[model samples]
Structures are given as structure tokens and as C-alpha cells.
Target: MTKPDQIKNRYNRVARCYDWMESPMETAKFSKWRRELTRQVTGNTLEVGIGTGKNIPYYPEEVKLTAIDFSKNMLKRAKLKYQDDPRKISFIEMDAQDMIFEDNTFDTVVTSCVFCSVPDPVKGLQEIRRVLKPGGQLLMLEHVRSKQKFLGRLMDWFNFVPLNIWGANINRQTIDNLKKAGFTKMEVNNLWRDIVKLIKVRNIK
Candidate 1:
């Protein structure tokens, strides 16, 4: 809890303001990728960093969903979104670095635009891999360091200040992290030359 304070503070402060802060076109485009990824989520699905539960409604009604976030305010706002359909969502206050769920309990692990912000991406990816069942997917929609070297360098330079202020590192190499975890089946679709990334990893059973 204390460890994720910066992450908590930023999102908590923006929980109510996020929709306004986020660009409509950017949000809509990202949602399309998430919707496509959701189609592969069968049986039990664990969604990490599910800020305000934005992806909740997009998932098929038949899917069993469990969502977690460290920010209390973020979860509070998300609860309001699901107030009418509470049974469809089980909200938990937890961290992605160490999920409380049993190993192999989830058939699909969903992460949307979260990897770039995690404090320790390798550990986070490891945790996601740990909870998934055999043949399960680690579906990710992330904003990573851009493929454009110049833009990526700029992001790296500015990444430190935001990391201190909000616990988000905008310059993570998430593609490498998945590989380090022994997840070899990689399908990465880029949006705008690497500003946004959609990665799906089929972990070994």
C-alpha cells in the first residue's frame, strides 16, 4: 500500500477527471484494441490496473471477470460505473506486483495501458504469468517507449520526473519483459509507430 502511494495519488487525484483529461479519439482507438483482446478472454479473466473499470462493459456478458487496482478512489469511481450491473464485476483492492490469487487460477490475464506505468514491469509480468492457467493468454494494451528513437529518447528523459510524481515509467520495454518470462508466442500490433502497443503472449502450459 505504502509502496504504491505515488501511483495511488496520481490516479486518485485524476479518478474523477480522467475522462476529461483523456482525448476522445485516443480513448476510442485504444478501446477498439481492448475489445478485440477481450474476445480471447474465456472462463476466468483477471484484469490488472483496471483503472475505473473502463474495459468492463466491453467484455462479453458470459465472461467471469475479476478486477483489481491499488487506488481506492479509482476503485470507488469504477464501482459507480458498475452499480447497475454489480454482479458482473468483483472489485478488489490489490497490487499487480503480487496478486493474491492462486497460481494458474485464471484462464486469461488482461492489462490495458498499464505496463508502461508499473514501477517494476518484469515483476508485474511475472506475476501475470504466474496466475494464468495452461494455454492462458497475457493480453496487454500498453503505451511503451516509441519505436522512433528520437521520440523514445525524449520520453526517457522525461520519464524520471513523472515516475517520481506518479509511479509511472513511460519508457518501459514491455516486449522484452514478456520474453524474459519465457512467453514466446508474441503478437504485437502497433498503433502509431509504437506510441501504443497491443501484445498477446501465449505462455507455456
Candidate 2:
């Protein structure tokens, strides 16, 4: 099976039950953080991972939205989240590693706690760069491994086991991945002592 299909199959198994039993406190905090991170965006936006459509309501007025997710089941949940909204958004089932769009098509690329789960975060980030117009920004809200030495070490030790079963890595350093993806103008500020970060990156190329 294709990678996207594998992702879909994996998340589909957990879709119906994920939102309810998932980390409530983490979800709430991430939701609040996404609001702050995305407040800087303007123009056409593509929200990668658009999981469960959790950030759909928080999208600013006047911005055109195109939400993409790898899993059909996740998009279904997100559709329910915006059932009554006056805003219209295009939801597409596409892999973040490769988007079916021309280069320089989008003005902004938004990711809310999505990098950790990508099978190849670097390749996915490169795709974000590929579709984003020059000087456009990539707005990200991510939970990263702690900057503190011992805590980071512990996260590294525990990440592999859970990533196999849970499909997300707790210790992924997304900021580093963005840099590797050729992002240069980056402003990263921690929300909760290095655990959560709001990163705004521009393609300086």
C-alpha cells in the first residue's frame, strides 16, 4: 500500500475514539496556542494535517482556506466541526510530503502540532516550501522535545516505543527540520518552557 494509504488506515482505526480519549489537556493547550500562532497569517492558507478540523473555527475571517489531511476519517471529523460555519473551506485528501499544486501557489502554510507525526518530516517540510510563494510564511504550533538536557534525553528514550504504537514522536525537533528544509527567517518562541513552540518561518530564498 502507498504511504498515504498506510497513514489513512492507521489513523482511521483510531479516528472515532481519538478525540475523546486523547490528551484533553494537551488538546486544549494546543488549541489555545494555535490561535496565537495563526493570528499572524493573511491571504490564502493551507493548513497541513487539519486533523479533526480542530482549528477550522479559529481561522481568521477574509483568509481563503484549503485544509489538507492524509486521512479521510480525520477530514470527516473536521467536516463535522465546521458544519454550521458561514465560512467555506476546501478540504483535500493529500499527503504533506507531496501536494498536487504548482510551485508558489500558496501565501501561507500552517501546521498545528503536525510535524511530529509525519513519516518524513523533512520531505513534508520541503513540500510546504515547494507550494509556498517566495517570502510566504510557514506558521507552526508544535510540541517539541524539551531544550533542557536531561528532559530531552528522557524524551528521546521514550519516543521510539510510543511512536510505533501511537504514531507521533514526543521528542521531534521540528524547528531543526524547518531549517533543514531551507527556512531562514524564523522567529520561534516557546509557549510552555520549551515543550510547546510557536514558530513563524519565511522562505528567505
Candidate 3:
């Protein structure tokens, strides 16, 4: 199978248990980060890799939210969380690397621990840049490779387990990947000693 297919398959297999598997971090840290990121977005917002709809409850009522996931099973789980909500929210199955949205379509885009699982991070990021209006921003709460040599090497060494089990790379150089994807105006703040980060990148086109 292709890389994208492999990722999709893996996440599909894990969708049933995805939220449970992430509960530890979700409770201790990610929940807070998700709230901080989701609550701040405005206008037409797109959420890439909206796995199990973890951020759904945190979104403000006013934003017209569109959440996308590549895995059908994952999207199914997400829909359950959002089904009864009265807000303007839509869910679609879409690959981040090749979104169906028109150019300059969104005012803000949000992601939570998503880039690590994207098969082609730069391509996915570029697609985000493509859909974002000029002056629009991408808000991300991601875990990336540490800059510290020892910790970085450790994450690299054990990257395969999560890559196979979760379809996520634990050592992604996301900041550099952002630069390569044409997001030059950025603010990166460490949330967990350089491993987890809260990033804001403006689409300066």
C-alpha cells in the first residue's frame, strides 16, 4: 500500500481506542492546550486531523467549523461527539496533503498533535497555506523532536513504535517543516520543554 494508505489503515484500526490510548496525556496536558487553541480561533475555521473530536467541545459557538480526518472510522467517532451540537459544524473525510477546499478559503486553521501523523508534513502544511486567506493563521498544538541532542536521539531511536502503532512520528522537525512549507511568519512557544509546542503561523501571502 502507499504511505497515505498505510497511515489511514493504521489510524482506522486504532480509532476505536484512540481516545482511550491518549487519555493520560489528554487529561494532564493536551486538554488544556486544546481548549487554549480551539477557543481562540474565529470566522471560517478548518480543523485538520480532527481525530475522535477531542477539540470539538472546546470550540466557540460563533465559528463556522469544518473538521476533517482521513480515516473514516476516526471521522465516525468524531461525528458522535458533535452530532447533537447546535453550532455550525461540518465533518468531512479529507487528506491533509490534498484538501478539496478552494484557495484562500479559510480565516484560521487548527491542529492538535496532527502533523506528526501526516504522511507528508510539508505537503500537508502547504495545503493548509493554500486554503488560508492572506493574513490567516494556523494554530497548532504539536509534539515534536527535542532540540536537546540526547532527548532528540532518544525520540528518533524509538520513533518506529509509534510510527507503526499510532502512525505518528515522535521526532518530527515540525518547525523546520513549517518553514519549508512557506509559513515564514511564526510564533513558537514551548509547552513542554521543547517536546510539545503551541505554534501560530500566519499565511503571509
> Which candidate ranks first by lDDT, i.e. highest?
3
For residues 1-205, write the lDDT of model 1, one tens digit per residue. Answer: 1256667788788777776656685476866776787877778888998888778878888888888998888888888889678446888988888789998999889998787666677788888888998788888888788768799899989987867655677888889888886688879988657777778888785
Q: Find the 10 residues in a row with the least total lDDT in model 3.
A: 1-10
lDDT per model vs. reference: 0.80, 0.83, 0.92
| Cα lDDT of model 2 by residue, 1-205, tens digit | 1254555577777778777756686476766776787788789999999888777767888888899988888888888878666768888988898899899999999998788888888999999999999999999988899989999999999987656654677998888898898887899898889888888888776
Candidate 2 residue spans exceeding 4 A from truth: 1-7, 26-28
TM-scores, all candidates, are: 0.90, 0.91, 0.98
Superior candidate under TM-score, 1 versus 2: 2
Q: Clashing residue pairs, candidate 1?
A: none
TM-score, model 2 to reference: 0.91
lDDT for model 3, please.
0.92
Question: What is the Cα-based lDDT of residue 131 in candidate 3?
Answer: 98
Top-scoring candidate (TM-score)? 3
lDDT, residue 18, model 3: 88
Worst 10 residues of 1 by lDDT: 1-10
> CA lDDT of 67 in candidate 3?
93
Query: Once all C-alphas are superposed, what RMSD does model 3 give against the true structure?
Result: 1.2
